[model samples]
Target: MDRKEQKSIIEGLLFVSGDEGIYPEQIAKVLEIEGNEVINILEEMQKECEGAHRGLQIVQYAKVYRFATKKEHASYYQKLIDIPTAASLSQAALETLAIVAYRQPITRTEMEEIRGVKTDKALQTLVSHLLIKEMGRAEGPGRPILYGTTKEFLDTFGLKTLDDLPALSEENEQMNEADLFFGSLQEISK
Candidate 1:
Protein backbone atom coordinates (compact mmCIF):
# COMPACT_ATOMS: atom_id res chain seq x y z
CA MET A 1 0.00 0.00 0.00
CA ASP A 2 1.02 3.62 -0.52
CA ARG A 3 2.33 5.57 2.46
CA LYS A 4 -0.84 7.61 2.80
CA GLU A 5 -2.95 4.47 2.76
CA GLN A 6 -0.63 2.85 5.25
CA LYS A 7 -0.96 5.80 7.58
CA SER A 8 -4.72 5.61 7.42
CA ILE A 9 -4.62 1.89 8.11
CA ILE A 10 -2.34 2.42 11.08
CA GLU A 11 -4.53 5.16 12.51
CA GLY A 12 -7.57 2.95 12.14
CA LEU A 13 -5.89 0.13 13.99
CA LEU A 14 -4.75 2.42 16.79
CA PHE A 15 -8.22 3.85 17.21
CA VAL A 16 -9.77 0.42 17.21
CA SER A 17 -7.30 -0.74 19.79
CA GLY A 18 -7.95 2.38 21.86
CA ASP A 19 -6.48 2.22 25.34
CA GLU A 20 -5.20 -1.32 24.79
CA GLY A 21 -1.89 -0.37 23.18
CA ILE A 22 -0.67 -2.41 20.22
CA TYR A 23 2.88 -3.57 20.03
CA PRO A 24 5.02 -2.65 17.02
CA GLU A 25 5.46 -6.27 16.06
CA GLN A 26 1.73 -6.86 16.14
CA ILE A 27 1.07 -3.82 13.99
CA ALA A 28 3.72 -4.94 11.54
CA LYS A 29 2.32 -8.44 11.27
CA VAL A 30 -1.25 -7.22 10.87
CA LEU A 31 -0.34 -4.61 8.25
CA GLU A 32 2.27 -6.68 6.40
CA ILE A 33 4.83 -3.92 6.95
CA GLU A 34 8.24 -3.83 8.57
CA GLY A 35 8.25 -3.46 12.33
CA ASN A 36 10.49 -0.44 11.88
CA GLU A 37 7.87 1.19 9.69
CA VAL A 38 5.25 0.56 12.32
CA ILE A 39 7.51 2.15 14.92
CA ASN A 40 8.02 5.16 12.67
CA ILE A 41 4.32 5.56 12.14
CA LEU A 42 3.57 5.30 15.81
CA GLU A 43 6.26 7.84 16.60
CA GLU A 44 4.91 10.19 13.94
CA MET A 45 1.39 9.82 15.30
CA GLN A 46 2.64 10.49 18.82
CA LYS A 47 4.45 13.59 17.59
CA GLU A 48 1.29 14.81 15.94
CA CYS A 49 -0.57 14.43 19.22
CA GLU A 50 2.20 16.19 21.16
CA GLY A 51 2.88 18.86 18.55
CA ALA A 52 1.37 22.34 18.81
CA HIS A 53 -1.08 21.48 16.00
CA ARG A 54 -2.87 18.84 18.06
CA GLY A 55 -4.67 18.97 21.41
CA LEU A 56 -3.58 15.54 22.58
CA GLN A 57 -0.35 13.83 23.62
CA ILE A 58 0.92 10.27 23.64
CA VAL A 59 2.68 8.50 26.47
CA GLN A 60 4.08 5.00 26.80
CA TYR A 61 4.26 3.23 30.09
CA ALA A 62 5.46 -0.32 30.65
CA LYS A 63 5.37 -0.89 26.89
CA VAL A 64 1.73 0.20 26.67
CA TYR A 65 0.79 3.50 25.08
CA ARG A 66 -2.14 5.91 25.30
CA PHE A 67 -3.21 9.18 23.77
CA ALA A 68 -3.45 11.84 26.43
CA THR A 69 -4.18 15.54 26.38
CA LYS A 70 -1.60 18.29 26.39
CA LYS A 71 -0.91 19.79 29.78
CA GLU A 72 -1.54 23.34 28.60
CA HIS A 73 -5.32 22.91 28.48
CA ALA A 74 -5.72 21.54 31.99
CA SER A 75 -7.79 24.35 33.48
CA TYR A 76 -10.34 24.93 30.71
CA TYR A 77 -10.76 21.17 30.30
CA GLN A 78 -11.40 20.87 34.03
CA LYS A 79 -14.27 23.34 33.71
CA LEU A 80 -15.66 21.44 30.74
CA ILE A 81 -15.78 18.07 32.48
CA ASP A 82 -17.57 16.44 35.40
CA ILE A 83 -14.76 14.47 37.00
CA PRO A 84 -14.55 13.33 40.60
CA THR A 85 -12.18 15.73 42.37
CA ALA A 86 -13.24 15.99 45.98
CA ALA A 87 -11.67 12.93 47.53
CA SER A 88 -9.24 13.90 50.24
CA LEU A 89 -6.90 11.62 52.17
CA SER A 90 -5.24 12.37 55.44
CA GLN A 91 -1.49 12.98 55.62
CA ALA A 92 -1.05 9.69 57.40
CA ALA A 93 -2.73 7.87 54.55
CA LEU A 94 -0.58 9.58 51.98
CA GLU A 95 2.52 8.70 53.90
CA THR A 96 1.49 5.11 54.25
CA LEU A 97 0.58 4.86 50.60
CA ALA A 98 3.92 6.22 49.54
CA ILE A 99 5.69 3.69 51.65
CA VAL A 100 3.58 0.83 50.43
CA ALA A 101 3.90 1.81 46.79
CA TYR A 102 7.66 1.98 46.92
CA ARG A 103 8.25 -0.84 49.34
CA GLN A 104 5.54 -3.24 48.38
CA PRO A 105 5.10 -6.59 50.11
CA ILE A 106 6.24 -4.80 53.20
CA THR A 107 4.90 -5.68 56.62
CA ARG A 108 2.99 -3.35 58.91
CA THR A 109 5.99 -2.99 61.21
CA GLU A 110 8.18 -2.00 58.28
CA MET A 111 5.70 0.67 57.27
CA GLU A 112 5.65 2.01 60.81
CA GLU A 113 9.42 2.09 60.85
CA ILE A 114 9.53 4.21 57.73
CA ARG A 115 6.92 6.68 58.95
CA GLY A 116 7.81 6.56 62.64
CA VAL A 117 4.09 6.46 63.40
CA LYS A 118 1.36 3.91 63.99
CA THR A 119 -0.18 2.83 60.66
CA ASP A 120 -3.49 1.41 61.81
CA LYS A 121 -5.56 4.42 60.73
CA ALA A 122 -3.52 4.98 57.58
CA LEU A 123 -3.77 1.34 56.54
CA GLN A 124 -7.49 1.36 57.15
CA THR A 125 -7.97 4.50 55.10
CA LEU A 126 -5.83 3.19 52.21
CA VAL A 127 -7.69 -0.12 52.17
CA SER A 128 -11.02 1.70 52.18
CA HIS A 129 -9.88 3.72 49.17
CA LEU A 130 -8.83 0.48 47.47
CA LEU A 131 -5.39 1.90 46.75
CA ILE A 132 -3.52 -0.36 49.13
CA LYS A 133 -4.18 -3.97 50.07
CA GLU A 134 -2.87 -6.82 52.13
CA MET A 135 -1.15 -8.76 49.36
CA GLY A 136 -0.32 -11.75 51.53
CA ARG A 137 1.74 -12.88 54.50
CA ALA A 138 5.42 -12.30 55.10
CA GLU A 139 7.64 -15.39 55.28
CA GLY A 140 8.96 -14.72 58.75
CA PRO A 141 8.08 -14.41 62.41
CA GLY A 142 4.35 -13.86 63.10
CA ARG A 143 3.76 -13.86 59.27
CA PRO A 144 2.33 -10.38 59.13
CA ILE A 145 0.18 -9.30 56.20
CA LEU A 146 2.17 -7.80 53.34
CA TYR A 147 0.99 -4.48 52.02
CA GLY A 148 1.06 -3.31 48.41
CA THR A 149 -0.64 -1.07 45.88
CA THR A 150 -3.62 -2.57 44.11
CA LYS A 151 -4.52 -2.82 40.42
CA GLU A 152 -6.89 0.04 41.15
CA PHE A 153 -3.83 2.16 41.78
CA LEU A 154 -2.52 1.26 38.34
CA ASP A 155 -5.82 2.13 36.65
CA THR A 156 -6.20 5.31 38.64
CA PHE A 157 -2.71 6.42 37.59
CA GLY A 158 -3.15 5.29 33.95
CA LEU A 159 -0.22 2.96 34.32
CA LYS A 160 0.24 -0.38 32.62
CA THR A 161 2.36 -1.69 35.46
CA LEU A 162 4.30 -0.76 38.58
CA ASP A 163 7.41 -0.26 36.46
CA ASP A 164 5.66 2.65 34.81
CA LEU A 165 6.35 4.61 37.94
CA PRO A 166 9.63 6.40 37.35
CA ALA A 167 12.63 6.06 39.61
CA LEU A 168 12.23 6.93 43.26
CA SER A 169 14.23 10.17 43.23
CA GLU A 170 11.47 12.48 42.01
CA GLU A 171 8.65 10.07 42.68
CA ASN A 172 6.19 12.46 44.30
CA GLU A 173 6.49 15.18 41.69
CA GLN A 174 6.53 12.69 38.83
CA MET A 175 3.50 10.88 40.21
CA ASN A 176 1.60 14.13 40.72
CA GLU A 177 2.36 15.27 37.19
CA ALA A 178 1.37 11.89 35.72
CA ASP A 179 -1.91 11.95 37.65
CA LEU A 180 -2.70 15.44 36.44
CA PHE A 181 -1.76 14.65 32.86
CA PHE A 182 -3.50 11.29 32.56
CA GLY A 183 -6.46 12.35 34.68
CA SER A 184 -7.02 15.34 32.42
CA LEU A 185 -6.75 13.18 29.31
CA GLN A 186 -9.32 10.77 30.72
CA GLU A 187 -11.70 13.66 31.23
CA ILE A 188 -11.22 14.85 27.68
CA SER A 189 -11.77 11.36 26.26
CA LYS A 190 -15.06 11.18 28.13
Candidate 2:
Protein backbone atom coordinates (compact mmCIF):
# COMPACT_ATOMS: atom_id res chain seq x y z
CA MET A 1 0.00 0.00 0.00
CA ASP A 2 1.03 3.60 -0.59
CA ARG A 3 2.16 5.76 2.34
CA LYS A 4 -1.12 7.70 2.35
CA GLU A 5 -3.15 4.47 2.38
CA GLN A 6 -0.90 3.09 5.10
CA LYS A 7 -1.44 6.21 7.17
CA SER A 8 -5.20 5.86 6.83
CA ILE A 9 -5.09 2.22 7.93
CA ILE A 10 -2.89 3.05 10.91
CA GLU A 11 -5.28 5.83 11.97
CA GLY A 12 -8.21 3.42 11.87
CA LEU A 13 -6.28 0.88 13.96
CA LEU A 14 -5.41 3.49 16.58
CA PHE A 15 -9.04 4.58 16.85
CA VAL A 16 -10.16 0.98 17.27
CA SER A 17 -7.53 0.38 19.96
CA GLY A 18 -8.79 3.41 21.94
CA ASP A 19 -7.22 3.94 25.38
CA GLU A 20 -5.35 0.63 25.17
CA GLY A 21 -3.34 2.05 22.25
CA ILE A 22 -1.36 0.16 19.57
CA TYR A 23 2.34 -0.32 19.03
CA PRO A 24 4.03 0.36 15.68
CA GLU A 25 5.25 -3.19 15.44
CA GLN A 26 1.73 -4.46 15.96
CA ILE A 27 0.50 -2.32 13.11
CA ALA A 28 3.36 -3.36 10.88
CA LYS A 29 2.79 -7.03 11.61
CA VAL A 30 -0.94 -6.80 10.89
CA LEU A 31 -0.48 -4.79 7.72
CA GLU A 32 2.52 -6.78 6.48
CA ILE A 33 4.68 -3.64 6.27
CA GLU A 34 8.12 -2.77 7.60
CA GLY A 35 8.17 -1.54 11.19
CA ASN A 36 10.24 1.50 10.26
CA GLU A 37 7.73 2.36 7.52
CA VAL A 38 4.87 2.19 9.99
CA ILE A 39 6.75 4.45 12.37
CA ASN A 40 7.42 6.96 9.60
CA ILE A 41 3.78 6.98 8.56
CA LEU A 42 2.70 7.47 12.17
CA GLU A 43 5.10 10.41 12.51
CA GLU A 44 3.70 11.97 9.36
CA MET A 45 0.17 11.26 10.47
CA GLN A 46 0.81 12.94 13.85
CA LYS A 47 2.06 16.12 12.15
CA GLU A 48 -0.95 16.22 9.82
CA CYS A 49 -3.41 15.70 12.67
CA GLU A 50 -1.98 18.69 14.57
CA GLY A 51 -1.55 20.87 11.51
CA ALA A 52 -5.05 20.20 10.15
CA HIS A 53 -6.70 21.62 13.29
CA ARG A 54 -8.66 18.41 13.72
CA GLY A 55 -10.77 17.82 16.81
CA LEU A 56 -8.88 14.57 17.36
CA GLN A 57 -5.14 13.98 17.41
CA ILE A 58 -2.78 11.05 17.65
CA VAL A 59 -0.52 10.75 20.67
CA GLN A 60 2.26 8.38 21.59
CA TYR A 61 2.94 7.05 25.05
CA ALA A 62 5.48 4.37 25.93
CA LYS A 63 5.94 3.62 22.22
CA VAL A 64 2.20 3.07 21.79
CA TYR A 65 -0.12 5.38 19.84
CA ARG A 66 -3.76 6.25 20.42
CA PHE A 67 -6.29 8.74 19.13
CA ALA A 68 -7.50 11.34 21.64
CA THR A 69 -9.40 14.58 21.70
CA LYS A 70 -7.24 17.61 21.26
CA LYS A 71 -6.40 19.37 24.54
CA GLU A 72 -7.56 22.71 23.13
CA HIS A 73 -11.13 21.40 22.99
CA ALA A 74 -11.28 20.27 26.62
CA SER A 75 -13.96 22.77 27.57
CA TYR A 76 -16.18 21.67 24.69
CA TYR A 77 -15.74 18.00 25.70
CA GLN A 78 -16.32 18.87 29.36
CA LYS A 79 -19.66 20.40 28.37
CA LEU A 80 -20.72 17.07 26.90
CA ILE A 81 -19.60 15.16 30.00
CA ASP A 82 -21.51 17.57 32.27
CA ILE A 83 -24.70 16.78 30.41
CA PRO A 84 -24.49 13.02 30.02
CA THR A 85 -27.85 12.37 28.44
CA ALA A 86 -26.65 9.10 26.93
CA ALA A 87 -25.49 7.26 30.05
CA SER A 88 -26.44 7.49 33.71
CA LEU A 89 -24.70 5.60 36.46
CA SER A 90 -26.60 2.81 38.15
CA GLN A 91 -26.57 2.69 41.97
CA ALA A 92 -23.92 -0.01 41.99
CA ALA A 93 -21.67 1.87 39.57
CA LEU A 94 -21.97 5.01 41.66
CA GLU A 95 -21.00 3.14 44.81
CA THR A 96 -18.04 1.56 43.03
CA LEU A 97 -16.94 4.95 41.75
CA ALA A 98 -17.16 6.39 45.27
CA ILE A 99 -14.94 3.71 46.71
CA VAL A 100 -12.35 4.08 43.94
CA ALA A 101 -12.36 7.85 44.16
CA TYR A 102 -11.82 7.98 47.91
CA ARG A 103 -9.50 5.02 48.32
CA GLN A 104 -7.75 4.97 44.97
CA PRO A 105 -5.08 2.47 44.02
CA ILE A 106 -7.36 -0.06 45.65
CA THR A 107 -7.94 -3.58 44.40
CA ARG A 108 -11.25 -5.15 43.33
CA THR A 109 -11.04 -7.58 46.26
CA GLU A 110 -10.60 -4.68 48.69
CA MET A 111 -13.66 -2.92 47.25
CA GLU A 112 -15.65 -6.15 47.40
CA GLU A 113 -14.68 -6.56 51.05
CA ILE A 114 -15.89 -3.06 51.91
CA ARG A 115 -19.11 -3.25 49.87
CA GLY A 116 -19.80 -6.88 50.83
CA VAL A 117 -20.67 -7.69 47.21
CA LYS A 118 -18.85 -8.63 44.02
CA THR A 119 -17.88 -5.47 42.08
CA ASP A 120 -17.16 -7.03 38.67
CA LYS A 121 -20.12 -5.46 36.87
CA ALA A 122 -19.79 -2.11 38.61
CA LEU A 123 -16.06 -1.97 37.91
CA GLN A 124 -16.67 -2.86 34.25
CA THR A 125 -19.26 -0.10 33.99
CA LEU A 126 -16.91 2.48 35.47
CA VAL A 127 -14.11 1.41 33.12
CA SER A 128 -16.34 1.40 30.05
CA HIS A 129 -17.53 4.90 30.97
CA LEU A 130 -13.91 6.08 31.34
CA LEU A 131 -14.70 7.28 34.86
CA ILE A 132 -12.22 4.85 36.36
CA LYS A 133 -9.24 2.93 35.00
CA GLU A 134 -6.48 0.58 36.02
CA MET A 135 -3.94 2.55 38.00
CA GLY A 136 -1.54 -0.40 38.23
CA ARG A 137 -1.18 -3.84 39.72
CA ALA A 138 -1.18 -4.31 43.49
CA GLU A 139 1.64 -6.09 45.32
CA GLY A 140 1.30 -9.75 46.54
CA PRO A 141 0.60 -13.19 45.10
CA GLY A 142 -2.45 -12.41 42.96
CA ARG A 143 -1.26 -8.93 41.90
CA PRO A 144 -4.79 -7.64 41.59
CA ILE A 145 -5.52 -4.68 39.34
CA LEU A 146 -5.63 -1.37 41.20
CA TYR A 147 -8.24 1.17 40.12
CA GLY A 148 -8.33 4.97 40.15
CA THR A 149 -10.35 7.85 38.73
CA THR A 150 -9.41 9.39 35.40
CA LYS A 151 -8.93 12.97 34.23
CA GLU A 152 -12.43 12.66 32.78
CA PHE A 153 -13.63 12.09 36.34
CA LEU A 154 -12.06 15.38 37.44
CA ASP A 155 -13.48 17.22 34.44
CA THR A 156 -16.93 15.71 34.83
CA PHE A 157 -17.01 16.45 38.59
CA GLY A 158 -15.50 19.95 38.27
CA LEU A 159 -12.63 19.02 40.54
CA LYS A 160 -9.39 20.96 40.22
CA THR A 161 -7.59 18.08 41.87
CA LEU A 162 -8.20 15.00 44.00
CA ASP A 163 -7.85 17.36 46.96
CA ASP A 164 -10.98 19.08 45.68
CA LEU A 165 -13.01 15.99 46.57
CA PRO A 166 -15.47 16.69 49.37
CA ALA A 167 -13.88 16.28 52.77
CA LEU A 168 -15.03 13.32 54.83
CA SER A 169 -16.55 14.27 58.15
CA GLU A 170 -14.25 13.54 61.06
CA GLU A 171 -16.41 15.14 63.76
CA ASN A 172 -19.17 12.51 63.56
CA GLU A 173 -17.77 9.51 65.36
CA GLN A 174 -20.83 7.46 64.45
CA MET A 175 -20.51 8.12 60.72
CA ASN A 176 -19.02 5.15 58.90
CA GLU A 177 -16.57 5.31 55.97
CA ALA A 178 -19.30 4.07 53.61
CA ASP A 179 -21.30 7.16 54.59
CA LEU A 180 -18.34 9.32 53.63
CA PHE A 181 -17.94 7.44 50.33
CA PHE A 182 -21.58 7.94 49.38
CA GLY A 183 -21.37 11.57 50.44
CA SER A 184 -18.59 12.19 47.96
CA LEU A 185 -20.54 10.30 45.28
CA GLN A 186 -23.62 12.48 45.78
CA GLU A 187 -21.53 15.61 45.29
CA ILE A 188 -20.01 14.30 42.07
CA SER A 189 -23.27 12.90 40.72
CA LYS A 190 -24.73 16.38 40.80
Per residue, candidate 1 scores C-alpha lDDT tens digits across 1-190 of 8877877787777667788866778779989989888778878878767667777666666766556667898897988786765767887777677678768889999988877779998899889889988889989789999999999987876768887764545545545433443454467457
Candidate 1: regions farther than 4 A off = 1-85, 169-190
lDDT of 2 by residue, 59-115 (tens): 999999999889889999899889847788888888788789888989999999977
Query: What's the lDDT for candidate 2?
Result: 0.86
Q: After superposition, how far is residue 77 of candidate 1 from its true place, in Å?
A: 18
User: Alpha carbon lDDT of residue 167, candidate 2?
Assistant: 74
Q: Rate the local accuracy (lDDT) of all candidates.
A: 0.76, 0.86
**TM-score of every prediction relative to native:** 0.46, 0.53
The per-residue C-alpha lDDT of model 2 at residue 131 equals 92
